[model samples]
Target: MNYSKLLFLFLICVLQSCTSQTKINGVSFVAAGIPVTDKHVNPVVQVNANYATVMPFGFIKDLKHPEIIHNTDRQWFGESREGVKQYANSLEAKGIRIMIKPQIWVWRGEFTGYIKMETEDDWKKLEATYSSFILEYADLAQEINADIFCIGTELEQFVANRPEYWNALILEIKKIYKGKLTYAANWDEFKRTPFWSQLDYIGVDAYFPVSDSKTPTVEECLLGWEVHKPIIKEVSDKHKKPILFTEYGYRSVDYAGKEPWKSERSMNIVNLEAQNNTTKALFETFWKEDWFAGGFIWKWFIEHDTVGGENDSQFTPQNKPVEMIIKSHFEEQK
Candidate 1:
């Protein structure tokens, strides 16, 4: 080929790469051991989620102990490396950029953000073990050409207390991996995180409550976002890093907007409209913001084709009115 033709082709490739990284329309695929079919993949693409977050779990029994870094033996706790590779490949095949987000699931259902260590020795051990766990996936992320790698997720206590450990971890991950990096900080903890300057993006698991209504209107949800958005923008400006809602969404139940982050609430009514409207409000509020880099809706399942419907109460916005809201918003972005 002539030099000019080669230059044009090179420019095309550069443009494609730029768009892939900057476009943050995304969704979180459930960490299922088995691969999901085209039926599962098609919807995300249809919704214009150019990115997908794959969360495979790592287990730490106690804050005083090191993480148990076993990918194969314990099937119930997390997706295997093989499973992650398969799912990542599947997403890439459908033109989706992948973010390999490995999260810690503590035994006895304790929140990872609440983990506490009493001694320096325990902290050191936790850092070393967690580094090994993160580096293993760092290698996998490099091999798969994944777009981003979240070094840690919602380990609020550790991150707040041990800035040196996280800084070292980010440096180590950069040595071996060539993708963007971010940490998924819980809604209340992002401002307190001290390591944002070392990473590519500020990631928030944005489950901030927008309202307390059993049946919230889109305007009400927008009001909730209005109250919270200034803080998000201020953080982005302080660090000069774009923000990604690494995880966001609500359960399809009554009063979802009241506590978007809650795992369970006393009210049990299956209010699909509440879920759908809250989602619509959030998109309308955030999608146009220049500093907002988009988000991954909390989750989707591989075991089943759909998670949200008339009768369901979980966070997946699939197979319901919320799904259409997602689809329309994403399509508009494209």
Candidate 2:
């Protein structure tokens, strides 16, 4: 009567329903210049993304400078701190877990990873200024009861060089924000940081290259992940901390899988299939791992509604096929 087969099928259905809601299904809400509208919030909730990460930027002119280049007195330049607190409140009202991730926007430099100070005095000044920037957000995160607070994002070399400074800063942040904390490290730089034990989760930006092929299938992308997963699990095990892919996504462009970490806009190629494939590969590969805490996909925007459709290519998977894949994956956890 094939009772064994029937039992297996029934168990599959039960498992599917059991994992339908995620522990931390998340997406990065691009709240920089955009207003947090119901239109945007609705879609994010629709995707079943319960976790929302909002980034506010603080700038720096050079590594040696003591001043952090932010215009608003106690707020980030473009996205004011008041604005972010409001957004976090709104997101929480809709039953979303929030992460306030403050990123460094280098004024005349390539990226934050390039920030390195030669002298201890310079490093101390940099730490002092950066600490002020982080503490402001920490106060807000505590005020709003944010689910997670990332102390810094992608200040790779600077953090690697001054572990003592970062450890002290984490201690200070702990004094303010009571929520879980993490630092978003570049994929290649997570292993180099010595302060993983100080934070709640090991946050990796997860832009690791999947495949070089312009049109790799979902299977090929999974193959790439297979190589990376063991290394990630090893780190998580060593640190006794679960890992979170703080930012992970693919641009809807040909060969986006080749260098998933590159933030630069490539040629005007809109390969929706490629983006979808990447989405499937990542979620299917990582979602069920015990040490894998879940991820926040690269971005979702509140403005430029027409920018990320079938004919356009960008990381915002808002109006594209990739979104459905995200929704389905997130839904599976419900």
Candidate 3:
């Protein structure tokens, strides 16, 4: 072979190898656990250190009348905003990618029974209320330099009926916020949502029942991913998008009969062994799935000031053994 031709062929091989190694979008494909800087590569595996604290935003409306129950005031906005910023900064300081979720659920206490957007006027009011809240939250996220911002969560009924409204809202958000965008959809109707193609990544609340019988054992809870994995893959294949477990949590409430064992006014704390076992099982099953971008735990705190009823112990990770598991998982990733 000619010397010039040999050199040209070698260069072509090098280019091909580089191209093959690279991934599309902002994710990077990795065999071992290694961080990839190039946005074009997709990560083979990643774990989320989710703090799940957004109810602070609802407290915004209750600022003026602290006496008024469940009316989140405006002053609380600044306080909540700062709290979220501090939390995001703390997570990012640990070299973790933060997915900041700004909640937009109807204040049931304020709205009485059901909240719906049945008419144009109804939607307009809803839009104004939520749009303002989202804008403020987005600004906070930008201030904190969060990696991902979830625009909304579990408002499936409203989002499904109002696609154009959400699209406009998202476009407006994109103008001010430059991070990735996603909406946490309810598990039952996530695929039916009309705006899958409109967002940066697919986010889902993947909390399928561990067992229809009683609360399953830790091993059973871990194996729940086996059922969810295929469902997630199907959604990804259909949409050609990466998946994030935006919300998945098991209630720690112990049960007496079929119903949750409720004390006079409080939910029983979940068995510590059960919680640890479940967390380990989840990590074992989901740590290596290539299609998953990451996931956030169900929650860190409750919305109401006082912890009562099922909210008292259902899903909060406060003081749980799982906290250590999360720290170790993130440290390993780092």
Candidate 4:
């Protein structure tokens, strides 16, 4: 071969190698009262998603409350023990991996991060109850042979104030569930999480604030990521673990990336382009990086065809312009 041709081939190979991504394209399947069926699983498969996070919730009255109530009448059928197994089996049969994520829902939509006890007695009580809540699901995760088991989700104060407790909890959980483990730290809380070293992957619910633009452009959001990418990378490097976005997505609304964490329920204009661009920027920034493992989009409903449309500006990409953008990225294997 000529020297010029050899050099051109070398450059092409380098470009492809740089762009390759080991992404675990995933969606957080929202729990429903009705059972999960092939109808529901088909959409996920169509997206070329290989992983799905199935969350069953336990509730608490407030941040200071010690008791975590679970498996009650108020819970949805899909969040129940029987529902989770069926969902796992159905999805796994179609060659999708499952991540059983047990999360705590504070009553009235209070933040789970602020859960702190006023007294040592109350703390102990909370510990015992929280442990029970997690362990019960841990056993369920093992039974289903889940690919990943998320021990907790966005409980920042609980982890910070009780490192020893979290350490012990990890040990206890390992004894029961022999699967990959992670804790879903809030986007901002993952840095201080003391136990990332003990787990398989450093999981973050990556709702990073990428831009303040009312209708942010993809290039603008990429600049926004330039700020957070290094800081998040620091954590991954320190612990020598890949970073998995346990939850990450933007709503199809104005200022979607300004505070990516907010649930915009009040009347807001739907900007399908804004959601598409912001989500595109995320894939551009993290997917190709070797240190960043992959992430699950914030939510996807069971009623796939009926869910989010042009008129709606929720986190879900369903039936929106962003859906196509996400699908294109997911379909691109590695």
Candidate 5:
């Protein structure tokens, strides 16, 4: 080829590489009692969301208990294996991609991160039980052609105490699931996770406290990200993996940015403006970045009409002013 022709091809290659990355404008699609149909899933498409996470949950009695409960009679429709398959099919039909995310919930809102055993034998038992829960879903993920399979979520101390178990678990999961892999590390714990290199994306439940002000302005929230953005980027750089916010959002309440991770019921005033500005700050700061792989908003219910309103002080941007902001940004990303 002539020099000018070769140069033209080189520029085309660079541009394609730069524009090929898809911003994963996603929602943590909440499980509901009834089977999800096209009606339940259309809003995700309406918002221009190309991705949605299907999170099946495992539960233990408490932080110390090794025995885990999953796919049992007490669970909701979307938490069972068949439910996941149904939900995933509906999403796929709509042309939305899937991320089968299996997370563990400790009883009584106990943090999964604090789970540790009193003895090695018990730890072994816990690992065995947890592996069954995850691996079963891994098979389903592969069967459903999920785009990604999350190995775990926010299990900090478990990972810290048993990194070897986690490494083995990842290999086992990769053996069964034929797709990308990620772990939803808590914001404070992602830096210490030892297995980012084994996964396709560096996943963080990035509820970083960005601002402390009551109903802080967008500029204030943006300033808060300045402190954290570089730190998060450094980890992605070290791992040579794009950063994916497995879960990231702000509650529609006063001081929403102060403790973005906390979800306990609060009597604080509902500040729609705070949630709107804080959420917009997130999209503005991270959505355009080349290294940031994009994010799933913390929560989105299947039913759109009655979920969130001005009076509700919840994490969901559903039906609120912030919803439009999310829609606009997602539209642009597509």
Candidate 6:
């Protein structure tokens, strides 16, 4: 090849390589957001990059379930903490800043078999439960040197009535925990939430249905994102704050035409398919949106029997196709 042609090709390759890579603290990050290469410059160095939240690092443990809590306390606590530590270690080792999300919520049954806070007493109990949970989780985050911490997840009814309580909670948390703080409000209620001013960033659990049908095509689902974009922009504009999707996912099962919302029915074929399709649609649409900082799937894992149910199945993220899709997506984003 001619000398000019060879040099032109070399320049093109260098540009492409640079475009596809980001380096922090000497560690190389690929497009997918995950660090593919790292050198031990110092873990704390990477913790400074201004990136969206770094997670799927967070999960909910049913404190009401003795067995679940026991297992988590005995094995998962250290293991999960260490796993996050390694993640932070890798990213920070490269000088990348990560936001850690540790969410506390009352499980489906723990709050009178519903996701809402129905009464004043219910709100009080939930507030207390969350307060204690945050204390424990905050300590864990500190141990792992997490960069940010979410104090609560979607408990809208409670938040609406107890705005002062949340302000108080944030104050108390600040006294103990030293990192960015936020609460994950449901997408519909995020605007009505009175506590956004107290948080470092507005965190939301945005799983608005992109399509009404059980099995919408990927293109149809992506189109639905158009509907949500304005809502996201409005929130960001009004609040004048960056947003994060703290919990977001769809079931892979089809609940289109089944009794008792078939997708919630255990061992029911209709529900299983609906769940799967919903899962597929969610991933397709999420990647298309640019307003979001980033979000964690509804969950990481759940107990075996805890899979089927109305709100339950939608929140469980373990062993699903969505998980693999996320891993691939983030890898590419890196």
| Candidate models: Cα lDDT each | 0.84, 0.83, 0.55, 0.91, 0.92, 0.52
Query: How do the residues 86-172 of candidate 2 rate in per-residue lDDT, one tens digit apiece?
Result: 778778888888999998777665678888877788878887788888999999899999989999888888877887888888999
lDDT: which is higher, 1 or 6?
1
Off by over 4 Å in 3: 1-56, 59-79, 90-96, 108-114, 213-215, 255-266, 301-312
Report each candidate's C-alpha RMSD, comma-separated, in the order given: 4.6, 4.7, 9.6, 3.8, 1.9, 9.8
Best first by lDDT, ranked: 5, 4, 1, 2, 3, 6
Estimate TM-scores for all models: 0.90, 0.89, 0.68, 0.93, 0.96, 0.59
Cα error of candidate 4 at position 323, Å = 0.9
Tell me model 2's lDDT, rounded to 2 decimals: 0.83
Flag the better candidate by TM-score, 1 or 4: 4
lDDT of 5 by residue, 120-142 (tens): 99999999999999999999999
Ranking by TM-score: 5, 4, 1, 2, 3, 6
Which lDDT value does model 2 have at 57? 72
**Candidate 5 collision pairs:** none
By TM-score, the best candidate is 5
The digit string of per-residue lDDT tens for model 1 on 96-187 reads 99999998878876788888788888878888888888898999999999989998899888888898777878888999999899999999
Q: How many residue pairs in model 1 have overlapping backbones?
A: 1
Residue 247 local lDDT, model 5: 95
- The true-structure Cα RMSD of candidate 4 reads 3.8
lDDT of 1 at 153: 90
Better of 1 and 3 by lDDT: 1
Among all windows of 10 consecutive residues in model 2, the one with the lowest summed lDDT is 69-78
lDDT, candidate 4, 1-334, per-residue tens: 9999999999999999897755789999999998888999999999889999998889999889999998777789888777888888889989889999998889899999999999999999999999998999899999989989999999998898999999999999999999999999998899899999899999999999999999999999999999999999999999999999999999999999899899948837888888988999999999888899899998999899999999988899988888888889998853
What TM-score does model 6 achieve against the real structure? 0.59
The lDDT leader among the candidates is 5
